[model samples]
Target chain A: MDRKLKEAIASKLMLLATVFSSLLIFAVVIGLIQKSRPILATHSLSELLLSSSWFPLRGEFGFYPFIIGTIWVTVLAMLFSLPLCLLTSIYLAEYAPAKIRAFIKPLIDLLAGIPSVVYGLWGILIVVPLIKDYVAPFFGYSATGYCLLAGGIVLAIMVFPIIIAVSEEVFRAVPHEIREVSLALGATKWQTVKHVALRAALPGVIAAIVLGFSRAFGETMAVMMVVGNVARVPSSVFEPAYPLTALIANNYGEMMSVPLYDSALLLSALILLLVILFFSIAARIVLLRIERRVM
Target chain B: MDRRKIEEDFFKGLMILSTAIIVGILFAIVAVVVLKGAPALSLSMLTQTPKGGYYLGKGGGILNAIIGSLYLAFGATALSLIIALPVAFYLREYASERFANFVRLSLDILWGVPSIVYGAFGFIIMLYFGLRACLLGGIIALTLLILPIMTRAMDEVMRMVAFELREASYGLGSTKLEVVSKVISRQTLPGMLTAVLLAFGRGIGDAASILFTAGYTDYIPHSLFDPVASLPLAVFFQLGTPFPEVQERAYASAVVLLVIILLTSVSSRLLTKRWSRFVIK
Candidate 1:
């Protein structure tokens, strides 16, 4: 094709892609503009947010149980993933010899590339049975190993790669001069890392962790597979529970066309979007705040 | 120094332990998926449909779903590349700061929008405009899901083409289009292709948007307006099954999806690895 023809064709292609997504966004904008009328709740939105009852089949759609379940699992997953991902990132970024770092980084890369479903199958086969027989029963439970512990434990494993990759990048982004500055101050290598390079990258580290949180919260398949999909507020960490993402992924296929059911699903999705958006914005804000402090 | 040695030893132990565990999980997951899925792979499984394409049934392989995923993803990627590049070029290369920021934030929010919400949005559009869970709906929805990544990637490629080189072209009395299209865009063709492939990777790996929007199909898609299935949806629907054989197939399908994503990401990263040269006069 002539240059004009090529440019014209390329422009047309770009037009098509933009228009495709434009249509979807237009649909979402319209839906937002046409909000359903608000229903009066005797309980406040806070109560609705905090209550743990999830009896959707019993004409009750309080999603507190699912939210709490999601929160506990997500929190625990982070608690486990954060330290490990940080330590690994530090090893890759600072401590490891060049050849060793090069050798090991691809493994982390491969871990990042694997899809969530693979982890779900592993959890079901390995983690669930182990939890059921060895851990849950020891804490006084039946043979059902699928519980918050199993789900949370596996979720930690799933997010480790993301945290390491992002945090490693952030750690590398710390200025060379900062390390020189720390060394000039007579600090040891570990002291420079702990007091200077890591401190410099703290905002980005926080951002990566928050992003990991959102990823864990948004994850559906693996958690849905292993969480056992129980709706009651988890009485303990060993009990089974549902997460918001898993709830939508599991129930949407067989929702039986109930109006409330559809609305409730939308509500949960909206809440998830808001929660992720909230964390994203919060991370940006935190970074901005850190920048201002440095300024 | 003694305490430091102990601390180093402790941290080293922690690092090796954690890294080994992470690597072990990845290997274990792959092995387990194969162990579960290998027996379910058969010739008929490749050629036949699953129990009328419902996850509740046991007999049908993902023949149609596999074909459907390819068609919808191919269509979506093609559509997205056609549309997203200029918008990205316009915003990143040509637009003012405020406009670019607005577009960037819009796409950032778009990327953050839940897949189910996107499906819900697609449903509203489909119902309102007489579109259904056919290839068109799925393509459009997947296009939306993929656009942010494409635009972002393409913009990065354009930005890396060097401002001084573009300025030199413009200083030679060339029009802005000549500088942008003939000079910058040409220099970054490989990068742009990587961008397109990356978007395709994300588009093909999705399950939730297709779950409601693409609907399901047990036959080859003969028209762009027909309901279709994709690999992620096939894996998803199959994983929900109670049948052991079908569940195994789901793992195999997931492994396939993971492999595709893995190749895409690694290839994109490899393609974009670059070095910069500076001149002094």
Candidate 2:
């Protein structure tokens, strides 16, 4: 082919690829909705989402317990990870010596690199037994190792790298000149961070936290292994519960033969996709706005 | 005055303490995985497939899962690259800034879509096509899972290729394709390699997306249509069984996975260092 024709064809191919990727999210959503039409046809959307009954074999597919369980674990994980991540990010961005910061950077990468399944194995081996033998007992509750609390703890560790990485960037993005001004005004280093850096980075930090929340919310295998897989609303941290991701992961194999069972699971996945997509988009928007303002 | 001093010291200590705790947990996870897994790691575990009654703690190894994981991840990464590279190039070279930004935003959202969603989506497509859970289906699912990640990573590096080089190429009567293929691709090759390795690591270790789309089997797959097992599912299945011996093998699988990831990350770092010298600043 001539160079011009070659160029035109290559450009068209590239544009086609771009269009394909751009439309993939829609394809996923539409495909899910189509697959899940059977369950939706039988039950109202609200009924699927709100009712707590979950007899998959008998055609009941209330996702309330799984939704609530996801909320419980995600919120609890945020509660555990946020303060530590914030503090650690603050230290890394502002206080840690350069060498320590360098050392911790790769450490965070390694933490993030460790597969979720390995994290799940770690949870089962260490966090679960610790919760069962020590933490729960100390709190005056006898418990199995697998529960909402174990899921939360494992998820907290899982989300630590994301939160810390993002928040550290946000904190660092607060200009050094601003901190100098605070110091010039006779503020302590802590006071400078409290009044200047943290205040300036609050939106970005919130965005980071939301990103972490979305990640924790969608996490599957790790949470599934530790969270007891019980289908119910967990009233306490020590109680077993099934999050939506776990519900789908645990049931996908067996659900195929049963009528509408796979559809229900797909609907649950749809819910997961929709929820995570919303949060992720929102967080990305916030982070983008922050980046624009900083620039 | 005393209160201010105390507050500063207290908050500073808290920050340091939190950092220490986070670091401690990283070490703890590795230590536990290594401690529990090393004893179970053996040549047979790497060389042999699970025998009959393997889940019953009979004589067997996870060679099936090991080979299966390699096939799936490698296939997925290659498939993702074919699409991801072109899309990334178009974003960086041909598209207008506003369009590029919009696509980047979409890619970011897709990146966060849970792996399970991809699995379900893949399964749905399989159902429509009268396909089974197999190696091809798994690759399709994982390609979707990693496509955004690879594209974004490549796009980030391409964006770093100085504007001056592109302009210079244009001055020499180079078409957009020539500038992209000859100038940009050569410069960003290392970053592209690293991104490939990164996606491969992710694809190899992920269990969720492939859980439904790639049905597990004890035997190593001989064809793309065959069901394939993976290391993550190996660990998950073994741990679910009541046998202690089987559970121990789960830890061994984890060790293998962890080592692969670590090697991927380390080699990427080394590869970047080695190749980056040829890259212009």
Candidate 3:
């Protein structure tokens, strides 16, 4: 009887633990909503989201510029990283010998493991200066070394490992028989990889890119350091811009002094949470489909 | 060259070039931090807290941040393990497939949620409780941040636990709890350790989630409620200064943080390998 009672208590405790773990997401969403209720109650959704002005001191809370900034930086990062990652992953998957693959794989993992602040330091020291001295002057822009371009480049480098790792897995998932069939049909090795392996892995590769994009969208510290925290719509890649993550990171502490400033920041956090959650869910679904198909 | 041959060679060359660029970038990051950060890394910097005007390149060290980071990461990892292990066990032993998938999807979403969002959430919770930014708050925030990661990793490890071992335990008339504790735990000991270490590395290296909730201080924290300094925040604040020397100090701090992460990662790899010998593959 005592042993049965002990088993019952253990089972109950484990169930409770699972319930608590699963409720964390709902709790975060609720906490964000409750905190931002003050602002959400006062401002219309369209005005809050659509207007470009974000002067918090004057009580203007339009996040349109930040939205545009986030979109631009994320798109630029994707543009820069996707091609490189695709090519590298293809090489690692198809061309490299086992020894080379073994050697390079861990290096990429280490790259992924480096913290964002370290990436920020590298960006401030290296990429920003390079862009400022050469790329900006060539484009006839004054070089402050902190601009959307710098942010995009830093973020691209930061997310490169993720894309490479994911895409490499996707490429490897393409059955060897697929490549063999293509090669036997008189296709070159490159042709087999491009036409057969890549096509077979298209869905997984797209999922990988989406996951990479989500990571870039939500990246805070490194992007915040390089992207000149100016709250304006950027007209050019060289122009300074403020992303949503940067806005939240830079201003959340001081905004408590203002009446509605905290609310506005909290609301932005809500929007960020919602956006990332949507993309993450979509990516998970796509990945799940791939896993099921492979099984 | 023939058209097809030229196309193939050109694309292959592009792949090689891209791979080289990626490798080059990684080396450059490590080189810049070590080269620039070495001069500033002194025994004083590692053993003492910042003195007056440390941000202005004056005397002092980042010992406070170093100790504070270890405290926070260790505390948070311990707290997460209590909840994560049980959840992992529940998912593997009790839950149905649909429910397990739902739990995994939720954890995946949580894992992808930005660290900044966790900061905001923690800050809001702090405000509601009328508590200030302190080590406790930071611990709580980081616990939330790493919980999903720990649980998922442990779940993966537990799933790898073979079924025949559990059957043998049951054949001995053992209960579900007994089988899990005796059979499953031994099998997954290495993976659990690796999961905990990975979460620790992640928690220690993160800056955004603790930025608001931790509330940096120059002194070491005396209690859980006292605000504390951390290495990532040290790097952030020092780098923000206009003085060149302080910026160099910031790089030193980055190097410190990098070394910590590298040690955790490499040790975790080694530990995983070492412990895998005992695991029933």
Candidate 4:
């Protein structure tokens, strides 16, 4: 073949691959919806979302408890991680010396690379027992280690790397000139960061938070191991509650045994996917806007 | 002025405390895994498959899971690379900036998707095609799980290749394909290696996506269609058993996984430095 012809063919193939990859997200959504059609046909959307009773054996499949459980864990995780991660990012990006920053960056990256299962193992062995013995007792609750609190704590740690990494990048992206101007105006380092760096990176910081939220929301194994797999809405962090990921992971084995059990689980998966998709898109938009502004 | 100083001092202290906690937790996780799992670590555990009553705290090893995880992750990484490489190259060389950005947004969204959702999606695909839970199914699931990750990592690296290099290649009267193959690929090879290692690490560690797709078996898989055990699921399953020894084995399994990931991250760093020495700044 001529060189031009070869280039044309190669470019065409590349485009095809790009298009194929782009279609996968839609394919996942459609596939899940099709599988969930059976359960959706029997129950109204409201009934699925609002009802708390979850008898899979007899075909009752309300996801209220699981949804509430997921929300509780996600919200609590964000509450735990947000302030801590932001402060750490601020320190790393602005306050820390170059040597210290270099040392810490890899440690955070290593933390991020640790597998979810390992995190789950650590949670089960350490965090669970601590919460069960020390934290819960102080909070006036006698509880199993596997509870919403444990799930939240594990998830918070899991999200810390992403949040700190993104926010630190955002803070660094605030040009040196801006910080210098603030300092030149007689502002202290803390004042400049609070007024200049934080304000300049607000959208990016929100994007980081959204990204962290989506990650924590979808996390399965770590949260599954710690969260008490109870099919009820948790009244407190110490209460055992079943999140959607755990519900799917724990029951996939027996999904085929019961009528519509698999469908219900797929529907729950669909719900999780849709929520994650929304947040990710939102974060992407924010990130893209920031990129454009920087350029 | 005094209040401002106090406020700064207070926030500074808070930042230090937070950093200390995060770093402390990182060390604690490794320490706990090694300390808890070392006693149970034996040569046989790394070399042999589980025995008949392994789940019941009987003697055996997790060689099946170890090998299965390697096969699954390796297969998935190779498959994803085939697609991800083309997409990354096309984004940089052929596509317009706006279109590249749009595709990147899609990839970022996919990257954030939870692994459990991918598992469910994979299960749906399996049911559609009348396939069973096996190594093939697991590989397909894990490829989907890691494709976005690999693509994004490669794309980021490709973006770092200075435009001047591309211009110089084009100035030599080289075709776009030649420029991509001969110049860009060489420049980005190290970064691409890092992406592959990163994806491989993720694919091996992810239990949720493979839990249902890769049905656990005590023996090493003899065929692509055979159900295969994996390290993450091995850890999860062993921990579920009531026997204390089996639970201890779970910690050991985690140690194995931890070591693999640590090696992956460390090697990728060293390799990136070693390979970038020849590239122009």
List the DockQ of the predictions in order.
Answer: 0.36, 0.81, 0.75, 0.85
Worst lDDT 10-window in candidate 1 chain A = A34-43
Please say which candidate is ahead in lDDT: 2 or 3.
2
CAPRI-style quality class for the chain A–B interface of candidate 2: high
Error of 4 at A8 (Å): 1.5
lDDT at A239, model 1: 83
Better model by lDDT, 1 or 4?
4
The parts of candidate 2 lying over 4 Å away from their true place are A285-295
Looking at model 2, the pairs that clash are none
Residue range B1-281, candidate 1, lDDT tens digits: 67866765777778778777766777787777777677666776667776653455456667787678778778889987776767776665556687576566567656666566666566656767887678889887788778777887787777777778877887897655566667767777777878888777768877767667788877778888888877776776677778766677887677667767777887777765531112111
lDDT of 1: 0.74
Worst 10 residues of 2 chain B by lDDT: B99-108
TM-score of each: 0.88, 0.97, 0.97, 0.98
Error of 4 at A79 (Å): 0.4
lDDT of 4 by residue, A135-192 (tens): 9999899998899999999999999999999899989988899899999998888999
Query: Candidate 3 DockQ score?
Result: 0.75
- DockQ rank order: 4, 2, 3, 1
Q: How many clashes show up per model?
A: 10, 0, 0, 0
Q: In order, what is each prediction's RMSD in angstroms? A: 4.1, 1.5, 1.7, 1.4
TM-score of chain A of 1: 0.85
Model 3 lDDT tens row, B1-281:
38889989999999999999999999999999999999889999999999998888899999999999999999999999999988998898888899888888899889888899999999998998988999999999999999999999999989887788888889999888888887898899999998999899889988999999999999999999999899999999999999999988899999999999999989999998998898877
